[model samples]
Target chain A: MSTPADTMKSGPRGRSRGTRTVIAVLYAVAVPVVLIVAWLIWAGVSPQIFFPSPIAIAEAFVNTWLGPSLTNDVIPSLARLGVAIVLAITIGIAAGTVIGLTPWLRELLEPVLEFFRAIPPPVLIPVFTLLMGITTSMKLAVIVAGAFWPVLLNTIDGVRSTDSVMTETAQSFRLTRAERLRYLVLPSAAPRIMTGVRQTLSIALIMMVISEMFNTSSGLGYRIVYFQRNYLIAEMWSGIVLLGLVGVFLAAVFTFVERRVLRWYHGIKETERA
Target chain B: MTTVATAPERRRRRLSGSTAALGILGLFTIGALLEVLPRIGVLNRRFFPPSSEILTTLIEQLGEGAFWTAVSDTLRGWAIGLTIAMVLGIAVGVIIGSVPFLRDVTSSTIEFLRPIPSVALIPLVVLLYGTKLQSALILIVYAAFWQVLVQVLYGVADVDPVVRDTARSYRFSRWTQLRQVVWPTALPYVMTGFRLAAAVALILQVTAELVIGVPGLGRNLGVAQSSGAVSLTYALVVAVGIIGIAINLFARALERRILNWHPSVRRDVAR
Candidate 1:
């Protein structure tokens, strides 16, 4: 099957370098410029409550988010997100690989996993609060659960789809089950596992915010909701904007990491070395 | 070794048809253990009620008219939000992806908007729509939109340029080229987007209901929990879980049927 990254290579390129740059600059700023203009017009014309202008938002961004709130709220949120992501990826890949190797185990767990997975993580806030209180542990628990399924499921699929030829080669060699899994299975499944991790990143971010928003304090989620509840509209907008920036940064980081990790896969495909 | 019946036993273990029974058995064992655990005081009965009691509550819920109302509301939110997302996602994703200039222009915006966790917008959405159905719609749509949009963008980007040039050489109209050349190549991605958006939409719908106090199963679960109705809360949660399984199975079935021509689907079929 063809991969998306493969399309970039060996495909026709139709633009000059200067034109490409012009297009890039124009395209990059178009939405922001248009949205700012629209915002200015809306704020100028109506002057309604809770509708802060773009300038108000910018100030709100710096004033509210630039100080202790950045350390107190934003740092905690990002920290929780980081922990949840690492936790999910470790458990998901391990469990998924183990189960995928034992196909019957995967099947036996299907109905069970699907049922549990479908229970939206938000619905557990009250339960978690009742049991674990609004502590960091409770938040981490929900975040891990929320971010886990994609990685686990994708890993299972990836491992199961490892080529029969690869499996046979391992069998023909004097490799133990552990060796086969570590050497043959994992390397073959890395691409799909990475895809799953990318999916998990977004879910972890959402879970981080939602878990914080519900009956909690000391995170961007709590801070954002706190601002809104107190009629601090500008501050709330700023928090949301900050949250957006955090997401962009995380995604950019993920793509860069993914490119590095997947470099070998791409390199082999491009050069037909495989 | 299964004594002298090793071959047959091995076949039964390996086959999905027989493994399905094992799956059912596993579920029953887990259910029985859950029923026993709370009663035995292994788990806190106050918070983690027995499975049987939860099942009783589930049965009672099914007989109640309000339960169905909440269920319908949840489904409605999922349907409407997913529809809006698919339409907008496909339209914008295709346009931006096809036009190289537009792709470059909108890349930053899409990257920025796509990752802004939808749950973070609960505050802004609540302010705009105020715990209404529209509030739920706003969250669900925003959350699911990115799933479909990204997939559609990839789909459009993956279109082979040779076919595109052929269409142009034949003087095929833009609309015709899109329908004939682009749609087929992108259909698989669209289906993928649909499945993903469907799941995300449901998750966000429940979330909106739970967090924003909207009218759905999630809201009912929240009420049940706060009122100290432990068994009922578990029951409602189980109901949501069942609904999720149903949706997933339905989506997989649809994908298999729709994408029969695709190699992955064919591979699954052959297996």
Candidate 2:
């Protein structure tokens, strides 16, 4: 159960600094270098349909992302993600708090939540399509349904983990139920709640893409599907790379926000105290 | 006073078990109601099929040869991809986690690559491998690999120093040390990663078929839905849900059996 900080303290060093430096450099340069070399080698040999080349992909990326043809795809996808996440956080936290605060409510709700959580969101995409039709609303609804469970379950766990003593103190001090929830429970649950938010973000992204792929006409997912159907290999690869870049950016932002928001829960502080 | 205390305790025990049962019952009741309401015209039947029809369709599909064919094809891709992912993921994760410099250097890259949804790679895969089983397997591998790798890294990194020191004191060979000490300590995390990977593998399997038309349950579901066999589509969706649940339950059972000594499982058993 040693914290990551403790591992840093006592683990073997073994030229780790030099190794890290080499790894960093390789990661930064290796992908583009390898891709370019592969393109060149393929171009020299056959190049008809076997390879699309790195430069082709780059040009495709610029046209798709920078130029005005279908760049708005990214925005709609982002907007769906934004709506889903906001709904997930707000509803998830509210419902989780009520259930966590009351044992009877938890007992009544836990099984239903578990059943829904077990069902994959992709399975529900067609059903949503039927209900809402193949529109942006359907896509957003799918994202919301997919993202809701993780955040809700995590929030419940976070609230349950709140100190009983603190709860009792609030009671003794005659704090109203709402006041106690706002002042004590929410603050204590914030770290775990954030973790839930992180999980929801990933799920939301997946559903957003899946819904678009299955039913929609305009998002990044549709673009990927559309390009594939037309046999535009370069355009398709460009979309994939763009999506990967988007994933990386979102994950980085999540990690940064998580660290800043959950500063008090940092492993370094825990290890230092220990 | 003693009788009163004992009565409350007994009631509490009864309540715990009954509450769980009640929760499950409540969920099913709601589902049943939803099914019935649509049939009765209280809810729209066109949008939502009746529960009886969904069940009948599910049973009929299960009996069909095409359904089994779809199941086997999907399972083939899932099994091959998951096997490869597990082996490579664990090996790479262990190497990276055990070697500090490697871990630090690869951390950023891993994080960068981790968020790319495996389904997003479907287009590139189709282009490279063509619209076939390989495309589906590639997507499954991509989906499952990162999950297993991250968990394996955490597992290796979590190995207790006291155990490592004890092994060292015994002058155990490196292989022996790793086999006896590191592997056991990391087994729980690796298993957890496998469980998570299983879910991802199933999802990716279906997604690949749906997007690429790769002859699986997903393709069947898509076909059924598009052809306006609404009941059949719902039935297939339910079948997929059951498969997912079965995989999860099997993983949990396996974990409990394998990690009987682990504190979490031990506590559950004691309860």
User: Which candidate has the highest DockQ of all?
Assistant: 1
10 residues in a row with least lDDT, candidate 1 chain A: A3-12
Model 2: per-residue Cα lDDT over B1-271, one tens digit each: 1111122232234346778687877777777987889978997888688878899999988899989999888878888989999998999998888776567657766777889877788777777777689998888888799999998998887787788888889999988988998898888888878877887888888878876788888888888888888889888888877777777677767766888797755655466
Please write out the lDDT profile of model 1 over residues A1-274, one tens digit for every residue.
3433343322336766776667557767898899889989999999867788989999999999889887888877788889888999999999999888887788788667767777776666767766676788989988888888878977887787789988998899979999998888998888888888887898888888887777776788888889999989999999888888878888899899879877887787778833
User: What DockQ does candidate 1 score?
Assistant: 0.45
- Candidate 2, after superposition: displacement of residue B263 in Å? 3.0
Q: Please report, as a residue range, the 10-residue window in candidate 2 chain A with the lowest summed lDDT.
A: A3-12
Model 2 chain B is weakest, by summed lDDT over 10 consecutive residues, at B1-10
Find the 10 residues in a row with the least total lDDT in model 1 chain B: B1-10
Q: What share of the true interface contacts does candidate 1 keep?
A: 0.68
Per-model root-mean-square deviation over C-alphas: 5.7, 5.8
For residues B1-271, write the lDDT of model 1, one tens digit per residue.
0111121222234456767787887799789999999999999998888899999999999999999999999999899999999999999888877776566567788888888888778998889888899988888889888888888887887778677778889999999999998888887888778878888898899989888888999999889877888898889888988888788767766866787787765655464
